[model samples]
Target: MMLKLRVDNQEIEAREGKTLLQACLDNQIYVPNLCYLEDMESPSASCRMCFVEIEGTPQPVPSCTVQVKNDMVVKTDTPAVRQLQRTALRLLLSVHDVDCKNCHANKKCELQNIAKFLKVGLKPKRLERYLKETLIDETHPFLIHYPNRCVLCGKCVHICRGKHGESVLTFARRGFDTIISTYSATDESSLTCGDCDTCVKACPVGALAVKESS
Candidate 1:
């Protein structure tokens, strides 16, 4: 059954089981999100950029993880929501490569786009930028994985797991030193990047890409 909900003072028709993010997007509403994929379960709500104010909630909640309900009231552009999003985005940018001009993703990058949407500069404002050692894995024949460009959204990991039975791309390490990785390989034959580009297509940012043949 279709449900009616109020989003930012606009009444929108959303389906019974759709998420708040899905409902908002279906209505052409713009919500800054980096971790929600359409066909996949939110494997990790690590991005923390989709916060919205729901009626009766003391704290802003991530919209991607909330289901839409009849008569539900949601405020997407509230001061609290903006603050949460701004802080989350600044943190993401702080550790990001921030080399947009030479980066392959460039104009098509989600991080860049969301930053623009939020009116936040890519340069670290109140926070200091932390640059980790560049990790480029070209072991796979068809693709290159740049850990620096990744936002840890897990889109690539979910796509790999969804398309195939196993997930080759995965999160490694913990806390401030965390990163994404695949199974370690003793030789080139052990690498499992497969021929499909599902992960690349699913990636909101251009962190993963096709390796040009030499």
Candidate 2:
């Protein structure tokens, strides 16, 4: 079934049960997001960048978590929506290492694109920047993890699980110290990440990369 809705004053049709974010993106309406993936059965809504104002809602809601409804009305460019997106971007930047020139993602980084879309600078003016002391984790045989550069969006984990039935990547620690950790491979035969770059490709930031050969 197809549902008709008005977004930014333009009529659009979305399949029933499709997320508002997916619907908008399908219609060429850009809503900044990072944590969302099309294959995800349940949206984490972790990025908090895709907020939209529904006509009857008191406040903006994350579009990735809302299903489209017939006759629904949405405004993506309202002051409240922009403010929420900017604030979320700034929060992500506070813990982010903004050395784009040296980063793997660089020009193609989602954080850079989202910052550009939200008109928020990569550096947070009011928020104190915090970074993990451990810059790199070399535990994984085929991959390197950068804690400072990660946005904790969990796309890599989700993709890894989807590809391999179970994920070798898992989040460890809590709060400001959280980082992606890999399960220790008992032996060469026990490793499952062999030649699999799904997690690396799924990372929106340059947090995961192929390690240089020794």
Candidate 3:
């Protein structure tokens, strides 16, 4: 079955059951996305970068999780859409440093690409760097942790708990205090982490990662 939908004022037909992101990519719309694994069934919608305005819908929709429907009209680059996307990116950047020049993923980071695409220079909100920095554990020999740069996107949590059978990481605490930490905040090498690196790879930002050794 094919579903007819409009994106950015252009009408196109796509597979009925595919997600909106899949449909857009299939149609070559290039909807910006991060924290979305290319071949995974999981649609975490953690980054909120693929938001689009759907006809008859007051609020924006997450294209990654939304299934295409007949007569669905979407506005991907409208003023409202841009504003929302900028807001989302700004919020994410608020918790993150603007030091892309010296970062590991300087040229390869999705968050940086999205920020560039949205033309976001700096967040409207004041920057308040956290005083307490999370430690980096290199004992696992496969991954590193830099919680200071974490945006609480839940991508790591999704990949750890969904793609990998081992539930090593999860969101602990709540609200401003919320952070992604291993279950019981225990040492990763001491547990059943499997060291798959799926969570680290799924992370859009450099929160959880396999650091390059010198």
Candidate closest to the true structure, highest lDDT: 2
Off by over 4 Å in 3: 35-46, 122-132, 135-141, 183-190, 211-214
What does candidate 3's lDDT look like per residue over 1-214, in tens digits? 9888888888899987788888888888977776565446767787778888898999888889888899898888878778888878777777675667756667777777787888987444565544225545444445676665677777777667676576677777876667676644445446655546777777777777764651
lDDT tens string, model 2, 1-214? 9999999999999999999999999999999999999978889998899999999999999999999999999999999999999999999999999899999899999999999888889998999999999898887777888999999999998998888888888888899988888858435567787788889999999999987772
Runs of candidate 1 exceeding 4 Å displacement: 185-194
lDDT of every predicted structure (CA atoms): 0.83, 0.91, 0.73
Query: Which residue pairs collide in model 2, if any?
Result: none
Error of model 2, residue 69, in angstroms: 0.6
Where model 2 places Cα greater than 4 Å from the true spot, the runs are none
Task: Give RMSD to native, each candidate.
Answer: 1.8, 1.2, 3.2
Expressed as tens digits, the lDDT of each residue in 82-151 for candidate 1 is 9899989999998888888978889999998999999999997788877667668775667788877888
How do the predictions measure up, each by TM-score? Answer: 0.93, 0.97, 0.81
Candidates 2 and 3 compared: the better one by TM-score is 2
Q: Which of candidates 1 and 3 is the stronger one according to lDDT? A: 1
- Is 1 or 3 the stronger prediction by TM-score? 1
The clash count for each model shown is 0, 0, 0
